[model samples]
Target: MVRSKKTEDDHIKVAKDLLLASILPNVEFDGWSSGAFEQAVIDSGVDISLVHQIAPRGAIDLAVAFHKKGDELMMHGYKQENFTELKYSEKVMQLIKLRIQASNTHKGAVRKGMSLFALPQNINEGGQLIWKTSDKIWNTLGDKSTDSNWYTKRTTLSAVYSATVLFWLCDDSDEAIDTWNFLNRRIRNVMEIEKAKAKIKKTSFGQSVFSFFDLLQKPSNEHKSGFPGYKG
Candidate 1:
């Protein structure tokens, strides 16, 4: 029987889930390749050939799927909270925290994956993954930025997240308390810069400078495009 498009997506999604579960404990040994995925398919009681149809990129595909699972888990928590009522900085902190906490279940697999991505050949995809993550976080936060700010926000958050994840991987501090503190400090630093910019933009000199700067800025960037994604 031929499957509908929706059915195909559903089938692929279920297979991805089973692959993730099966791969999480074994990715370190197999390194997220087609061989590992084949085992996962077998473990899930599905035909291994389906992997070629659903996700042909092999390890990279599985890694992306794994990362998105964390995004879904994080988004679930974002939905459960009074996120809209929270201050913008608070909301961002919560989003970051949620992502880290969600990864707790498969940190080991992620750690190993990180090492794989760190290789020179794989580094490009690694960077893309970080951007994808920041995109997912912003989407969950309802960001609608479409300018340089969009790029800047994701770029900065990618750095912040990359550093934090590396820290969390080796964090010997109790319950990762140090990691949380580190996160708070990073968020606080960003908030401080934002406040300073806001204040500067309010002054006469600041207004003129900004007006000139705006003239030089990309015309498409009419809306402010960073985290909190305030519309101008």
Candidate 2:
């Protein structure tokens, strides 16, 4: 009997998850290095060749998988919450907090993942991952934007998320209260920027300028294309 592609993919995902579980303890010390991957292969008893096939870039691939896993967990928690009563900014703040809490137990792994992604060669991938997280947050919050605001919103949120994550990693305060406060401040800063834009739009000159730019900027149909900010 021939196995289906979906079956094969599921098997690979399981293998990857096993490897990730086995590597977490080591990641704190090795920072997603080849040694960590090798150790995980031995610990997981997953076929070495299969492990390589699943993660060609070795532990770096697992690091990416770990980040994505946190996103999944965050989204799951988001769905469980009652956000209807919260303001939009409060909802966003809660989402960010949830995302951070998703990885609270694995701060060591997260810290190492940050170091691994901070490498010059991996910087672009790191940025893309953060942008993906921001996009996920906006989509979950029901953002219907298809214009340049889509890009701007994700860009601004990405900055906030990145800064919050860094602050969170260093937060040794009681229950990370400091980090939450910092996140609130960042969200308020973004809100203030939005308020400023609203004020600008109220002016005749600002309206004319925005109208001209709106005409020049084409809406991005991201659903049709895989690229997030593609405007075609």
Candidate with the greatest TM-score versus the true structure? 2
Off by over 4 Å in 2: 1-6, 212-232
Query: Where does candidate 2 have its weakest 10-residue lDDT segment?
Result: 223-232
Prediction 1 TM-score vs. true: 0.79
**Reference-based lDDT, residue 202, model 2:** 94
Q: Model 2, range 1-232, lDDT digits (tens) per residue? A: 9975678788898998899899999988888999998999999999878887888888888998899889999999998999999999999999999999999989999999889889999887887788888888999999987666777789899999999999999999999999999999999999999999889989998898777655533244545344542211
Which segments of candidate 1 are over 4 A away from where they belong?
Answer: 1-6, 33-35, 199-232
Tens digits of per-residue lDDT for model 1, 114-150:
9778889878767776777777777777787654555
**RMSD in angstroms between candidate 1 and the native structure over all alpha carbons:** 5.7
